[model samples]
Target: MMKTILLIVTNIEQYASGHLKTGLWLSELTHIYHAAKEKGWKITIASPKGGNTPIDPESLKPLVLDGISKSYYENPVFMNELAQTKSLDMVKNDSFDCIYLAGGHATMYDFPDNTTLQEILRDQYESNKMVAAICHGVGGLLNVRLSDGEYMIKGKAVTGFDWFEETLARRKNEVPFNLEAALKERNVHYRKAFIPMTSNVVVDGSLITGQNPFSSKEMAKVVVSELEKQAFM
Candidate 1:
């Protein structure tokens, strides 16, 4: 069966600080986008307010923009799709086999407390479907509560951008809240790499996560593998 993936991103363009810009991290989405595309999975991009999604300017820098991201940026169809993402309000949660939250510092602003997004997360998770997020995308999973009123990832082993990484990058002051702290508050078993900026991926059944942009592709591959496993059985 051909699988479908809901690629969710932040609509926020800048941070509260006003000096720094933050939006969707390109590689986080591009890597997973290509990976899923190679597997012939359909993907839909959506945001909370449902319109244009902002790609972080820093992500497009020559130093950061690799061939994959550069090609994605150059694709008019892909750029148009990102610029006009469907609204989350219009999304049917059960329509897709998986939901991938693409990360950026902006995701921290809108992902955690959005009730509608939480509903989608709960729907996908409780249905035994794959739910994955990378980098700041992990913020989306922080507040997802199932019908039983338990945090969706309470006992699940997961990995995301760590406090050490944030502090190392000096973004702790600019971010709205501490991601690692919020994960802990929700009783999540957060994991990270021994060294900052290193890739890390964690797969606990249907719940899959990657620590940073470096791990997004790996996370996507694992998602494909998990989907294949489910299809076989």
Candidate 2:
């Protein structure tokens, strides 16, 4: 059977300022999508609201957009997934081998409070299935509590977009809260790339996370490797 991945994307199109545009970080999704695609895995893109997810304009810049992400941007079929995302409720009963949360500044605004997202994550996590997130998408993991009422990431080693990176991005003050601090408060052994803006991934059991956009490819590779390992077991 083909392995399945449920990719959760954010629906928010802009930051709270309303002037600075923000949405899904293209590479964050494309990198993982292509990696899983290479393994012949089935991928489904869904969101909190069900339709029309936006792409962050910053991610499309020449300096930031990689060839792989650009290719997906140009591919009509792949882009269409963002145009018609299934709502969280739509996939509540679906089973997937892994659940990945793609990131962007927009995720900081919407990913944390969605009860539906929390429920889905709780289900996937407590079931011992793989759960992964990158950059600001880690926000989605913030509020996910297990059936025992403990935060899923509590005491687990994880990594995500850190405060320094947010400061470097010049959106430190614009963001609603400090993600690194939030993770720490949840009792997670939070980690990040020493040099910043580098590929950093942390896997603690079934939960996997990446520190930033640069970490997506490696994160996806880890997910695939773990799944493949289990396949032969």
Candidate 3:
């Protein structure tokens, strides 16, 4: 039987001061979606608000576009899946073998501090399911707590779009808060590439994370590898 995965994206548009537009980064979803499809896993998209999640226009630039995401944009069926995404409230725990959070500036505004999302991560972690996030999407992990009342990410080695990447993108001032600073404040062992915007994926047990949009493909490969190992075991 093919495994099922739930991928979450943000519905927020403007990140800060309504200057920097935000939505799900198409590359983040496409790389993982295609990788999972090739490995025979079914994927579903969900959002905190649900319905008609938008894509960041910047992410759709020819230089950033991947073949899978470009194709996904043209496929009516796939577009409909994104158009009618399930709300976080409607999802049940333990239904998916893996849960991935895709990133864009919007995630910083909506993905973090969501109670429903926190519960989903808690349940997924407790069930030993693979939990992954990339770029700003790692913001979603900020509030997740384990059943024992400890932070799910406490002391874990993880990576996400770094503060330097934000600076490179020239949105350092527009972002509400510094994600790297926030994670470090919580005692999370956050890692990053030496250079900004490089592809870096980190896997620590059941938790997997990628540094930026450039890292999503590697992130997905790592997750699928873990899932395959678990399935055989």
Candidate 4:
């Protein structure tokens, strides 16, 4: 039987700041999705509101988009998936072996405060299914509360789009909110790359988090590794 991966992304097309376009980070999804596909895992891309997920324009820049991401960029079939993402409500929590949140400035806006997404994360997580996110994608984990009425991240060591990293990228203000502060608000034990924008992936049991966009591919490898281990047991 094929394993299933639920790759969640943001549907928000742009930021309120204007002029700066935002959506899903192309490489974030491509790196992981392609890996899962090669393993013959069934990949279902979902979004909060669903339908026509947008891609961050900056992620497509010549400096960034290349290799697997560049290939996905030019493929019409892959492009169609962005326009055909299933809504969060359409997903059956029990069907997926893992749920991954993709990042972009768009995720910073929509990932948090979504009741449906929160429910899915909470249910799947409590059931021992794997959950992962990267960059601003970590925003989705900050607000997930457990059945015990405590924040899921309360004691978990995690990391994501850091305020300092955002500053280094010179897009701190462009981001919707201070994700670092929000995670701390729930008493989340947070950490970051020793060097800014470094590829950092933290594994705390079933939950995995990445420090920045650069961490996406490695993060995917970690998830695949975990899946491989689970297959043996």
Considering lDDT, which of the candidate structures 2 and 3 is the better prediction for this target?
A: 2
- Per-residue alpha-carbon lDDT of candidate 1 for residues 1-233, written as tens digits (9 for 90 to 100): 88999999989999998998889999999988998899888889999999899999988899778799999999999999998999889995448888999999999999988999999989998888889889899999988889999899998898888888889767888998888888888777788888788789999888999998778667777888888898888
Model 1 misplacement above 4 A = none
What ranking emerges by lDDT with the best candidate at the front?
2, 1, 4, 3
Q: What is the Cα-based lDDT of residue 153 in candidate 1?
A: 91
TM-score of each: 0.96, 0.98, 0.96, 0.96
Tens-digit lDDT track for model 4 on 1-233?
46889999999988887867889999989999999999998899999987989999989998778688999989999999989999998885457899999998899889889999899999989989899999899999878889999988888999988888778767877877898888888887888888887799999989999888889789989999998888888
The candidate that achieves the highest lDDT relative to the unseen native structure: 2
TM-score of 1: 0.96
- Evaluated with TM-score, which candidate comes out highest? 2
Q: How does residue 72 of candidate 1 score in lDDT?
A: 95
**Per-candidate alpha-carbon RMSD to the true structure:** 1.1, 0.8, 1.2, 1.2
Clashes of each: 0, 0, 0, 0
Candidate 3: clashing pairs of residues? none
